[model samples]
Target chain A: MDPAKLLDILGNENRRKIIQLLANRPCYVSEISSRLGVGPKAIISHLGLLEQAGLIECSVDEQRRKYFNIANNMRLEVSVSPYSYTVTLHDVTFDRGKNEEDPVEKEIPPGEESSTLFLKLSSRLKELKKRQEELAQMQQQLQVEYTEAMDHCLDSIEEIARNPVECELLFELLKNETTLATLCYNLRLHPSIVNANLIGLTKRGFIEYGIKNNQYYWKIRETGVENE
Target chain B: MDPAKLLDILGNENRRKIIQLLANRPCYVSEISSRLGVGPKAIISHLGLLEQAGLIECSVDEQRRKYFNIANNMRLEVSVSPYSYTVTLHDVTFDRGKNEEDPVEKEIPPGEESSTLFLKLSSRLKELKKRQEELAQMQQQLQVEYTEAMDHCLDSIEEIARNPVECELLFELLKNETTLATLCYNLRLHPSIVNANLIGLTKRGFIEYGIKNNQYYWKIRETGVENE
Candidate 1:
């Protein structure tokens, strides 16, 4: 699987929120939408992208209502150094879909680091194959949680990008700092429209206003790239 | 470090190429530029992103030219199953920077699989703490080549994206299928310009032309996302 594409898809804050919710327990589109306070259409779009990336999967229930959850027994581990990085996708054959409950919530026995966890799992792998499979299943779920937490920082600026006017304003700000008056004039937009865009952008961490030459100038924030 | 950000940065084809080249051995900017046949400015931009993501570090040598190499003892493993994934970053402390020569060039012993490799490393961790550290350092370097090989499928499409005309044409094609003649007319560009962009995009696996309604139409390839 393409880790970069997967990263890009899950980079969305809403999508990550969806994953977090599903990682806790399976939820359908409307439930996820209501819980996250996002539109159902947007949630479905996010789910489609996640499914295309193979990050999540949907299963239909008896009433034919689709439930979304993380794909079972999927684990991604990425190790990086200065010169190189490794991505390994383990398709551990764990029956997590039916038997496991809140697979990602497996608590680490306090004070246990990954090495101990590895040893514990390794020992299990050495025992009867069936027992080994069970332990790998648990490890797989634990790993899913670990990966999601690691990527929580990559929450995307996609929501801001959904608004063309606001996105354009942010991009313009990224080029150079300008006063609201100057921006309104330059973009041929009315003062009120520009002000609204600026307000929205600022609230979303896209732009910041500061005094320059004793006048307020809006400049794009460093995290502006988080926007699509 | 933000694994998602790191993944996003490395998602670029040029950056991955830089990593692949450096993994073979450290190379200066000009040398890497020549090897990849890309312009110096683009290589520099790619390098800057990699360094910012902490995937690489640079050192200045005698004569003041900067050389780039992967950071020592950094390992990333990503495992994916249908349901979940895990990313583990290991900052193994070993003085392999001095003792190890061409660390990524370590050859696997004949008939050894990754499971054996893991088993061997796991057992070593069960030994004395110092011995475990030594084994981990070796494992860290050994993992370098393994990861590079694993991501071989994620080849870069960055070259196609470097050209605005080509990139725009590819994006346009993604919208719908259109014959070259129609695209030239609609996009208000000459046939030669459209054809050149088409060829560049096609060579990079960005688009494909096929006969529809007895006329050849261009459609964006699925791999278009591989471009930066």
Candidate 2:
């Protein structure tokens, strides 16, 4: 199973329980539905997700199909020690059914798969950036001017910067590991307006960024941004 | 915010990220959208869920109405001592808007609020049990029973005599820390099946229960439920 897909699937609480059910031993779908106390449809919904993640496999017996088995190549390791502990998080990927012939091995190192995935990821990112640039150039050639609500939202921000709810969310986004774009989108404002806020913060030296492919890694600074 | 509602809202990955975003300070919709690379519309959808959960609130500022803030009152108390430590696990609760005529004077015990909540919860359970029983009796009177699928979902002592998850959940319920309903709901199953599972396990002498309203205190036997 693609470790990335598995991670996304297991990221769900219901799917986690389904995986736990199969972890003990393989049982038929009906048995799982009974034990889990969920409708067959619900169980199947989660089961399909889990199966796609490569956490479990199924066997067909006559007309009745039973699911019983963990993926041999599945990598979910939890090592506990006094000082250091390791949890090799996995996610589902596109290439899943390829290595069914050779038994999958587990436990090499925590960052090994990530490094491998990153190598491919960087190349993909480059291709994506190139395509985005092409799109931008095409739009430019078409003399297309973007209509972003930057000025509209900036007017709103300046007027109600002290609004309790807005302030609270601003503070929260910085504290947690979330991106600025997430905050803006959640607020249903234009990306340009969000970019304006980022720019304001950048000028105030409260948020820093490094741009790559028209994307910025907005990092929080020690001093609060001078919205005022 | 209702901690339970917040929990449910944060329970999803996308929603959780939105909440995590607000952990720092207030921001607007556009910031959230661009940073996450998600469409502003999608982030708005998630924000709507968070708002309904009361984990978030929105504000209209001029032309650009920005969503910001969380409704929470609980604070975390982390106390560390030599060899032993106390950690206060509190979730924010909503309070009525009232005048504070007097200066803050008293210091209350940390667990006092939890105690009051529990007291209210017990009475609430009593009401629910009375209603559930009335419904159960009515169904019986009507000679109507749940489908075979539901009956099969009932906990089977024979099948899960040594199941680890059931044992852990039962132990917690018996300790007054939670209820079977909570366990079933969290596990994404019907509550009735949870009860049946408890009943089956209890009959096998693997667990013991003393019912108070609908809640039944269930615990493992002398040897205790085996982990493996």
- Measured by TM-score, the strongest candidate is 1
For residues A1-228, could you state the per-residue lDDT of candidate 2 as single tens digits?
A: 332343355445565555555543456878778877888999887877656655566787776666655443232322111111122332212233332332322232233242232223233333443453353333222111110111122222333343544443344333233466766655556777677766755564444666656765555443333432
Candidate 1 fraction of reference contacts recovered: 0.21
Per-residue alpha-carbon lDDT of candidate 2 for residues B1-228, written as tens digits (9 for 90 to 100): 332343244345565455555543355888778756788899988888867755567877787777576444332211111111122223323222321221221132233242232223233333443453353333222211111111121222223435655644443332233456666754565777677777765565455556676666444443333322
Which model scores highest in lDDT? 1
For every candidate, C-alpha RMSD to the true structure in Å: 31.0, 21.7
DockQ each = 0.08, 0.02
- Model 1 misplaced stretches (Cα beyond 4 Å): A2-17, A34-42, A61-64, A81-84, A93-228, B34-39, B77-87, B93-228
Q: lDDT tens string, model 1, A87-173?
A: 544444333333224343245443314223322332232233334234444433433333222122111222235476675564455
Local distance difference test values of all predictions, in order: 0.55, 0.44
The TM-score that candidate 1 achieves is 0.39
* Prediction 2 global C-alpha lDDT: 0.44
